[model samples]
Target: MEQNKEMTAQESLQLISESFNKSRKDILRGSAKYFMLWGALLTVTSLAIYLLWHFTGKPQWNFLWFAMPAIGYPLAALMGKYDEALPQNEVSKMLTGVWRVFGAFAITLSAIAVFLVPMHVTLIIVIIMGLAECMSGVLLKNWPIIIGGFLLGVGGAVFAMLVKNDAQLLIFTLGGVLLLITGLVMKLQYK
Candidate 1:
């Protein structure tokens, strides 16, 4: 009877381990695609903002930043609809929570920066985004993502501070590149 209990416990542990592994794979696969999508969108939007603002000498071009989510969210939703359904798992829930918080915080800060407070909004957002990426990488145990996030979060922050005027938009371009690279790496590894 005691041996039976031990076997049952061991079997349960094995089942849990298998579930974690399976869910991690599914989540990482989906997330890799999202990283690529957002990365490309960010890169293109940042460049467009930089050009329009630089040539026109109008800060209002910054408003284009909002277009990112306008496009990204719908595409992401569509992609989610197609992805194989993932099982409920701790890692997935944690990752979802992290991104949700980030989205809310970013939206709030962007609104305040645009409407009420004129601050170094670009750098602040980049830093926060980097930290979030790094956190995601840590959760996924992906080295490229971790490194990319560190570079974007810390190095990008420093670079943004040093660069002057409209040049700051280039930081987003760099961030997008990093994210793109990370996504490619993940895709290759996971595939």
Candidate 2:
């Protein structure tokens, strides 16, 4: 039989703190792969869309942007499955919640841009992506991610504004490169 010992408040708080720290480290370790994965997909898709739109002279090729999520979600799901052994914690839950909300916002805004509005959807999406990444960095206490998000969000937006027509798609490529570097930094640092 095990004896039950009551923990003091200080000891309980310490245990909670330890758990949170451990959860954070685990989440950060796994997040690098996701950054790289999405970054690669975004880069490739942007290039493809750019080439198709350029050579074919069809602006409708812009719809190919949707392929990023189509490919990324399944791969991410597989990665998440592999990581299922790790216990769920508050940090993980919050990060997932943040991304889910961002995804919804992106999809909704893209749809609205395609169907109703004549706004700069690429600029808006890049900003949202950067905000989401920066929020994740804030939660994970990662500087590289924070800096990357700021560059992709602000710099990319400015670049998008300056470039014309098909050139705007290249902004996604720049954002993708930033994300890829951020992920590499995280992988090396965490390892």
Candidate 3:
């Protein structure tokens, strides 16, 4: 009887450990929603900007990029509400904090870009996004995210070096495509 009790206790402990690990995985997987949303938004906006500038040659079209922050903030707030309702673990809390800081930095950089060097806005934004993505991946232990971040960084560098003047639209379009593909792959893999 004592041996049976011991075995049962061991089994119970094992089950509890497995359950905790699974919960963590679930929280990590939930991140895919944000990735997909941003991916789609970037892809569509980049393409639209590219087409508009390429055909019409209007600099004002660049202002459309602001739509990202406008849309992203509300969506992030909703997601944060949902997250607040859930019982988050330490890892989840840390991940949230990391992203919050990233958002703040992005906003600050954007404001500076608007006031100072508006022409390099796309490259600056992409590089910042790449760093954020890489940091998130490191924190979450997600390889796809890390790879995606590197791609964004490389794309930004290429854009900065190769494209000058209004032709930078190509870089934005390419970055958008890379983001979209990365998000889709992450969603499918994590789901």
Top-TM-score candidate index: 1
**What lDDT would each prediction earn against the true structure?**
0.82, 0.81, 0.69
lDDT tens readout by residue for model 2, 19-73: 7776767666677787798779888998899889889989999888787788899
* Candidates arranged by TM-score, highest first: 1, 2, 3
Q: Candidate 3 lDDT, tens digit per residue, 1-191?
A: 24455557788899789888777667656665666666677778777877887789786787887787799779877886777444667756775676577667766776777777555666676677777667766766778778877877776777777876567766656655665665566556545
| lDDT score, candidate 2 | 0.81
Model 1 poorest 10 in a row by lDDT: 1-10
Model 2 residue 180 CA deviation in Å: 2.1
The per-residue C-alpha lDDT of model 3 at residue 172 equals 59
Alpha-carbon runs more than 4 Å astray in model 2: 1-24
What is the C-alpha local distance difference test score of candidate 1?
Answer: 0.82
Best by lDDT: 1
Q: Locate the minimum summed-lDDT window of 10 residues in model 3.
A: 1-10
- For candidate 1, write residues 1-191 as lDDT tens digits: 24355557788899789867766776666667777888899899999999999999998998888888899899989988987785646766776777778777877899899899988887888889899889888987887788888888898889888997789999889888877887787777665
